[model samples]
Target chain A: MDSQSIATTPEELDRSVLPHAHEHPAFLRHHFEDVGQQREAASFGMWVFLLTEVMFFGGLFCAYLIFRNWYHPAFVAGSNTLDITLGTTNTAVLICSSFTMAMAVYSAEIRRRGQLILFLVLTIVLGSAFLGIKAVEYHQKYVDHHIPGLDFSIQEFVHPSNPKAIPLAPDMAEKTQLYFFLYFAMTGMHALHMIIGIALLFIMVARASKGAYTEGHVIPVENFGLYWHFVDIVWIFLFPLLYLISRYR
Target chain B: MTEKTQETHQDAEVHVVKPPVYLAIFLALLALTALTTGISFIDLGVFNAVIALAIACFKASLVVLFFMHLHYSSRLLKLTVAAGIFTFLLLISLTMTDYISRAWGMF
Candidate 1:
């Protein structure tokens, strides 16, 4: 390690010493060795943050698993009340949004400014649509008095309207509240993430329209795509666990 | 690694996933979603939940691998994701051991 051999100052560093100096775009941070290092560091940091998110959501999943096993019948009844059509529709909507987000990232990478903006806007619209459908589902729950701690009633569970449905004892019927509680907690958290993702999408679209991400600075767009996809992945698990698992049972 | 080598490596690593690939993955995910929903209505007994989760896992893998570009990502990022999932499984399994061994069906 010859200290004197390396250029000690920014001005001293030039194409003569660093042959690839011209490739260092202005957006590259000074502390990073190059664009690649900067991109990797940023991606690594984002993933670490997402890992913490995994743990956060994992706790909720663990609780749901234990309780669902303990009160299997209550869970089945509670889950059956959910509108499967809406649930499936929302899942498809979110999957489409993820597809649009991937296209947005691709557009940014290829430096197609118009396409980038278009896809970002599309993602935002689809995300909002997802939230709109979720609102309808929550409203249905409200109308049925299924919101835990608000105005919950177990009459439907106690004497189910479906002829083939198995009725629950009053005590078991009360356990349905726990199922609804987990449902609201998990889906509410997921919805909050979608709301945040949509809000960020607006900002990304604004910046993308200004040629921000298309000019060889695509890290922001790429990282946000990761986030949007992560949210979609959460829904992938969420759909089956909350809506699909107990349907046939 | 020299600056010149890093520049060349960066250029090599920037593999732009095409629109067709994204579309293919998207369609596959939607199909899997529909399949899982469909299967949930059939009373497969214990396997109903199992199949639903299996399909969900497959759907998530597609998003992660292609859409999220984990397939093209560096090993460091790949291991980071795997580690996160490993820890999550550990948490669930460890807790279950305690719960399952104690009171059995008492809950």
Candidate 2:
């Protein structure tokens, strides 16, 4: 929690704003009343940031909804091309990671240093496994010529290799590019957030190894838990919206 | 229950969520994921997408309430989250309404 104490210049932090002066820990910032107030304020700020993230991704979702409704067959064909096995596995992996992250926050609260380190490591591994599977899917898409730049082609949807898949007319197949575009845009944005989160996890690991958060200071762990769960929540929506599009006949 | 609530009232800083709570939420999420996937395999016409979205919303709520610990948080934080969702709905409804009402009378 106090790892960021170095982030702000000392002179700028007004100790007066934090009124609970009776036996406070060093990690409790001078600008907060107590650890409770500090934790609440930090979480409130985190939720605000998450709210911004909502609207940010909302634009992409809005586009997906309109385009999907407009081109139902193209959407269906395009969705069927997705590897359900990998998508389901990734969903399970992310859910498991969210579980581990919640445990990590619990470990931090209880001041269990070893469990904290272990859970954080597990989260990093599970998160990385998700990215590895996602990378495999992206590479497969690239090989299938589904990347939506000028190199993009609709042969897959136009003449699907899978007999079970609905075939799209060439023009409608071109519309499949729109579907793929939204797919990459949405999932790619999600992967970018995962990459950033993994990077942060590494930093947290290094700091936690040094007993940074095990000393009755859990704001950082708690706040980061909020963030990790938020990423999972986004995937919770994405799994159905992207992967399960009228998948039946 | 009264004693537990009183303890929390005094020590508001550290709220330790039991591991069982987390485990239960995790299982619920996994079960919902399975349900959504299984349901998608049936052709329910227009109901399919609606049901899928509804399930997704339910799973997201679990994550928000338990995993994110918003249930234990303050009212202002809850309102903030609600406002975000409201604005998102506003965006979706307004856009969908425009598109849906575009060529109204001809039908």
Candidate 3:
């Protein structure tokens, strides 16, 4: 790098500079106008990407609402089959993970590298715990034959083992399979996002421990925080829709 | 690897959220979760699903407004977020018209 080209620090790049004379961080791409513009563009792009993800999940949610309305009794029976204890625990776990992710972003903004590492680690742990509980829940579903297109048995819905269990006709109980299909499709999709988020968190934690996100280069951590929180929001809706659908009935 | 030399807020400002605010939001979310679970035991008639979804929307709004920092972000960013949600609502509402109308003997 020439002497003139080497002088473009973030401050220099932000100030008045004649064309290529401005300096920037090594991580800055050649296409960006400057650090600020790069950060803005990166964030904007992430939001657009997140919008697409929203629509992707929206399709599943739309199907859920339609089917639940059509087969309320079957849906209710299928919902009750879920272990609310584990569902609630998973919800709390995800909320905590979202909290840790926000704290990680805050630490990055403040340039607290140590705290950033700590927060990222905490977020990953919490996220993994949520997935662990979810696995247990899924395992129980497998044992009870609730997995649609698999060994899904309608016996539970048609003939309740519990006195308080909601009753459904055998035909309506067969519709419970549709409910389980949506349940797996929705929650499984959410879990897939969580798995991917945790994997990305590992990469961020490594870089954060090396003090990568501090010093005004927090765009990465900040963008990832948005994603982590989006996943949490999905679960926020999912818990109530799938686990708590008219349980009192 | 480039070293993080000096702290610089050269171009834009990053909001540093307080710890207490996050803790408060976390607690509120947990409490709401518990409330939803507790209320599920008492039949709210046809309003059960409505109340649960309302509570969920409330909790999600808190996370979006504060934790996500959309409150402090640029208007464009806020608009983008709003657009996404609006589109989702549109999808739901438009499709529901068909489902509900069919049940009304529209065919």
Off by over 4 Å in 1: A1-23, B1-12
Over B12-68, each residue of candidate 1 has an lDDT whose tens digit, in order, gives 375689999999999999999889988988899889888998898889889989998
lDDT of 3 by residue, B11-88 (tens): 234456788999999999999999998888788887888899999999999998888887776666788889988988
lDDT for each residue of candidate 2 in B1-107, tens digit (9 for 90 to 100): 26664555354444688899999999999998889888888889889899999999999999999989888877777898999899889988998888778845421
User: Scoring only chain A, what TM-score does candidate 1 earn?
Assistant: 0.90
Candidate no. 1 TM-score? 0.91
* lDDT score for residue B35 of model 2: 91
Judged by lDDT against the true structure, how good is candidate 1? 0.86
- The order of the candidates by TM-score, greatest first, is 1, 2, 3
How high is the CA lDDT of each candidate model?
Answer: 0.86, 0.84, 0.83
- Candidate DockQ values, in order, are 0.67, 0.49, 0.46
- Better model by lDDT: candidate 2 vs candidate 3: 2
Q: Could you tell which candidate, 1 or 2, scores higher by TM-score?
A: 1
Give the Å shift of residue A91 in candidate 2. Answer: 0.4
Candidate numbers, best DockQ first, in rank order: 1, 2, 3
